[model samples]
Target: MPGGDISDLDKNRVLAQWLEWQLRQVRNRIRELEVQELKDKRRAEQARAGQRWKIQPQRSNVAALLHRGDCSLYSSEMGFLDREEAIIALAEPDIEACQICKPETGLVQT
Candidate 1:
């Protein structure tokens, strides 16, 4: 009754528009959070990778190559090797250290 009479339909339309705007904002926030979550997950994975090592199987006549877990030259879905395990792998005559990442640099020779 104050500030002129407004139709019920107009009020409903305005309410619907406000609800839609709120929904969009919520969805945008969800998307941003999802992106942040993905980044955190990737960073965690990289950190884990850095602490481990991996072996790329020999291809053709080439010997198996040892690499730092974070090395991108070879991607292995297989389990990683621990520090001692990496040293052991390096000891193998058939296993060669990666020239790029130089996985042997992290190990101490006994």
Candidate 2:
């Protein structure tokens, strides 16, 4: 056999090594994809499980505020703030600032 020419045994060995490397790469990619899928599934499940209630303030006060136009009720269709965050903003004195009337009285007068 010529020194430059690959023997059958040498070619077989090289082919085996190449196939092994390819399989390893494929397996690594599969594992990575599986791990990412699991993570995404866990995140989605957690989001579903941690459901939050819509903000429903005490009726009379909210009605009064709405009636007087002292406070504006954000529409559900509005994209600005979530109900929970809006409620929190309402409850917190520091966050509640009147846009039109007296800035001192944070709570909307009705």
Candidate 3:
């Protein structure tokens, strides 16, 4: 009877260790999934924001020129271009050429 009881205790210890390891694996997987979900949500929000911008355009002639490759001028400093310069460049009466390109401002400003 004594030997049988010791064997049972050993079996129980092994089972408990296995269960603990499985639970840890499950918790780690859940954490990984949560991080992936947050990343996916951020990407979706960015896509939605881009779509909104497409729906409504910002008013700036420099923006339009930058959208096209006709002019090689680009702002080297980090700030919003003066509104007057944008207006003048965009309002050129004779530059009716169309070029295919995307507008890229280096950074967003508050």
Candidate 4:
């Protein structure tokens, strides 16, 4: 009966090791998925940032402001401007490009 007891102990040890390995595999997969999710989130943010431009209309005493799509200084919930629209906006006498985002850096004629 002692030999049978030893056999049971060995089987239990093997089972514990297998379970630990499986746990490690699951943990590793979770980490990989987390990394993938982060990358996808960043990609989506970049897509939103580069896809369009926004303008803040003139306020009481302030001129209208132009901003990059990703600019944090001013947020306009109105429709976004395309490249040509941005260029035209920059040409307006009262519209000025945002200093922080420099929305006219690429759009202005040299």
lDDT (CA) for every model shown? 0.92, 0.48, 0.46, 0.87
Summarize candidate 1's per-residue lDDT along 1-110 as a digit string, tens digits. Answer: 56898889889999999999999999999999999999999999999988889999989999999999999999986879999999999999999999999998848665
TM-score for each predicted model, relative to the true structure: 0.85, 0.45, 0.45, 0.70
What is the RMSD, in Å, between candidate 4 and the native fold over all Cα? 3.1
- RMSD in Å for all candidates: 2.2, 12.3, 10.2, 3.1
Candidate 4 lDDT over 6-75, as tens digits, reads 5777889999999999999999999999999999998898688766789988899999998998888877
Among all candidates shown, the one with the greatest lDDT: 1
Alpha-carbon lDDT of model 4: 0.87
- Which regions of candidate 1 fall more than 4 Å away from where they truly are? 1-3
The order of the candidates by lDDT, greatest first, is 1, 4, 2, 3
Is candidate 1 or 2 superior in TM-score? 1
Query: What pairs collide in candidate 1?
Result: none
Write model 3 residue lDDT over 1-110, tens digit each, in one string: 56556587788999999999999999999999999999999788654443221101234663333222222333222233343433344445533222432323322232
Best by TM-score: 1
Residue by residue across 1-110, what tens digits does model 2's lDDT show?
68789899999999999999999999999999999999999788545422321222345443211111222332222223333444455666434333343222433345
Name the 10 consecutive residues with the lowest summed lDDT in model 3. Answer: 49-58
Question: For model 3, what is the alpha-carbon lDDT of residue 56?
Answer: 16
| RMSD from true fold, candidate 1 | 2.2
